[model samples]
Target: MKHLKIIALLLRNSLMSHLEYRFSFIMWSITSILWIMLTLISIEFIFGHVNSIAGWTKNQMLLIATVFGIFSSIMWMFFLPSAINITKLVRKGTLDFYLLKPIGNRFLLSTNQFSLDNFPRACILVLIMFGLIDSMGLKISFLSWIQFILFLLIGLGIFYNIFFTAAVTSIWFIDIFNLEDLYANILNVGRLPTHIFEGFTKLSFMFILPVMFVATFPAQILLGTADITMAITGLVILIQDLRGKSMNFLGFSH
Candidate 1:
């Protein structure tokens, strides 16, 4: 209960900070929208030349874009901020400040900061996704909705483990700033359906790198195209990876 209150206070303070700088906040929001629009327009240009990319229809692709946006916004909302804080805290050896606090290290690190800008963008993308789905007349069942939510949770779990592991690794490699962009780049690959790639590349993304968890599997669930066996396998592999990586991080931290 105390931790919840602390997180709530932090979120309120973060959003209020943005309101304190209205023009910059507004301009930043606008910039974000324009970039999203540009991506959509580029998709439009591509479809102008062909009926579809890979096996995905235009409406399906739009849904993929929507799913991608959800994943991206999540990164910005929680994972990005926490990973960044950990990196800086580790590098400056300022992590001890939080350690000395009453809060648990994980709790303090996870809820220390957030960018309120991402919340509105996530809501907008969700609204746009539903609107696009409506326009496309995609018939989604109740079961599919359940699957979508489940897979989304699984993806977020994978996302946290992946980026948090990277941040922990920075304790040993303090000078590398590019590790910051690593998560974002991985998320970018999720902007398209996995079917678009063939042979080894697709397998690498789906299993080895597991970028598919960030967007593809959830998108498949939303679109009612999910393969249950594959989805279950993905979740299992992620769980195993999480178990293994937790030990790896503990090994490094201690």
Candidate 2:
């Protein structure tokens, strides 16, 4: 309950701060929507030439793009800002302030920063997803919905762990900037169907890097073709990553 209250307070503060700069917030929203539109236009153009890519129909590809957009929005809103901020804090030697606080340093560092600008992107992506489902005539069962939600959470966990672990490495290598750009490029790959890859590339994306798990698995679940073994493998990876990172973060905090 205490942790929940802290998170609520952080969110309230973040919203209030962003509200003070209403023009900037509005400009961010406009640019974000424009970018999303351009992305969708590119996808439409691709499908205009080819009926399907890697056996994925236009609607299926759109669904994957929509899912990736949703995941990207959430990551930008909550995780990316904090991850970048941690790097800055570490570089400036101000992370000790968080360490000195009574709250857990991991919680403080991860939750202190928020990007309210991405909220609109998240909403738009969700609406797009629903429209795609309707157009595709997908009859998703309740169990599938539950499974999709679970996999989405697992995807978020996996991403957060990988991202934060990279950020935390700033403690040892302060010059390791541009991690965000590197990860962003990797995430862009998730916009396509995992079926497009073959052999080693597919194996790397499935286990080594696992960017496909971030969006592909959830989209597959919606399409009623999700691989249960793949989902279980992702969950296990997430658990192990979290376990290892928690200990590392605790050591860093002290």
Tell me, by lDDT, which candidate is best.
Answer: 2
Clashes of each: 0, 0
Best model per TM-score: 2
Cand. 1 TM to true fold: 0.92
lDDT agreement of model 2 with the native: 0.85
Instruction: List where candidate 1 sits over 4 angstroms from the true fold.
Output: 244-248, 251-254
Clashing pairs in 2: none
What TM-score, over all chains together, does every model reach? 0.92, 0.95
